[model samples]
Target: MRCNVAPHTFRSSPYFHLTRPLTRRSLKSIEDGLINAQHLDDQIPTELAPGNAAVLIPLANVMDVPGILLEVRGKMMRNHSGEVSFPGGRVDATDSSYVEAALRETREELGIGAQDIEILGQIGPPEVNLRGNMVVYPFVGFVHAGSSHSDHTNTVALDEPLPSCDLDAIRRNASQTEVDAVFHLPLSALTSPARLRASMFRGNRPYWAIGVQDLVSDIPASFKGRMKQIEHDDVDDSEIGPGKYGNLEVWGLTGWYLYLLMKKLKLYY
Candidate 1:
């Protein structure tokens, strides 16, 4: 199937684009900025293991509204039940590489075929949750423009409504699960100040916030109320409420990956 998403306007912020090529001096400057900003914590022990996993960050083309595709797992699933995440799983013996595993699982979960996706690059190898100490390799892939899939497919028909939006789906999915929900947040969100905030959590508690940019001022009142209700419920369970304007406080491995990616790309605002 061909992905037929509309084209969304994406601009590179002046803050994000460096004037010169990244040299050792420039790299050191960037690292120093992060260190001085107190964003680096070297105390956490690095846990590297052999288990492999993968996830596809599916991008849809929408006019002035590029978005990432995200899935909400059935609550009955064994691990990360009801969590909002990218469609992926552990590497099977038949899978040749982590990239292959990601593409295959995305095909299985979203009815997105291997031929329809263009692999961009990788982000990180974070720790996996349920698979007895497995490392997850996340790859960025772009769904072919104008691609279309049917409702009759086994994947889309079984999963709940697959939302494609600018970071809103991430917040909504995380709010529903009350656990660390995986997300491929847009680079645009990290460029604005009003849409971003820094959060501090209890000792070693992973916490970071990714604010949304260019949000419509008049969001439907009903949707706003529903979001409040979801936040209230999550708060009762000791999880942070859905953040301002329905943005999420990314935590755990998700937050770590985002942090690292932002640092590496020098894109954080």
Candidate 2:
């Protein structure tokens, strides 16, 4: 379920300066972190049958710029509408494993198939009872933008590479019904020390979260106050967003994922 591109190949690409290889040590750490996260295990309850869900953390060198694939959900959706997120949804009963559900949801959301992706493995245990509705399983993997084809066959290669910032290749294959737009943020952006900031919850279980400043600047002045409201309540769209800012809004669970992944890659401490 995993695939590896030659380290030299990734290094030689135009995006080499912006991207680093996902090393074996980091991959092992990611798996170990998830497996050993006692806090994640504690979130599940014995009586509740967790509603399983999965998401794919797809990374790739697109037109020589290494970036991660993310989706802007359609505004008409019932939940998390118009939010940026990894491609995935609930694991249907027919699915055999978390891997299957992740790949299936990815295919449904982005038209990406198992053949095009090299599944790296799981990250952390299922983030259980999220918003009190479902348990989410996150998987990290590599996606090759050059290998994309309308038919899901690997034979077709692009006549010309896409521009580094363009997302048309991915958008062309995405499901318009579920996705309003598709975008890629250079993986290099997350490692910047200056753009990152942190805030303390200062509650009973006081914790700190890292976020990109200016990314959520439009959030109402009451944003921190709202935190107290939902600190122990089920999440709803009313609490979904301060909305997207110009720069990619990588925060909350998604930001935490980047923090852990980048830390494991040794890009950040």
Best by lDDT: 2
How much lDDT does each candidate structure score? 0.45, 0.52
**Each candidate's root-mean-square deviation in Å?**
13.3, 10.1
Residues 39-127, model 2: lDDT tens digits:
55333332323376777888755556666777766656677665557788877776777777888988888888777676655555455
Q: Which candidate achieves the best TM-score against the true structure?
A: 2
Residue 50 of model 2 has an lDDT of: 37
The TM-score of candidate 2 is 0.62
Once superposed on the true structure, which residue ranges of model 1 sit more than 4 Å away at CA?
A: 1-51, 128-132, 147-186, 192-207, 211-250
How close is every model to the real structure, measured as TM-score?
0.51, 0.62
Residue 146 lDDT (model 2): 42
lDDT of 1 by residue, 97-158 (tens): 77888898876666567776656455643444533466566666555432333221224322
Q: Model 2, residue 81: displacement in angstroms?
A: 0.8
Candidate 2 has its poorest 10 consecutive residues by lDDT at 199-208
**So what's the TM-score on candidate 1?**
0.51
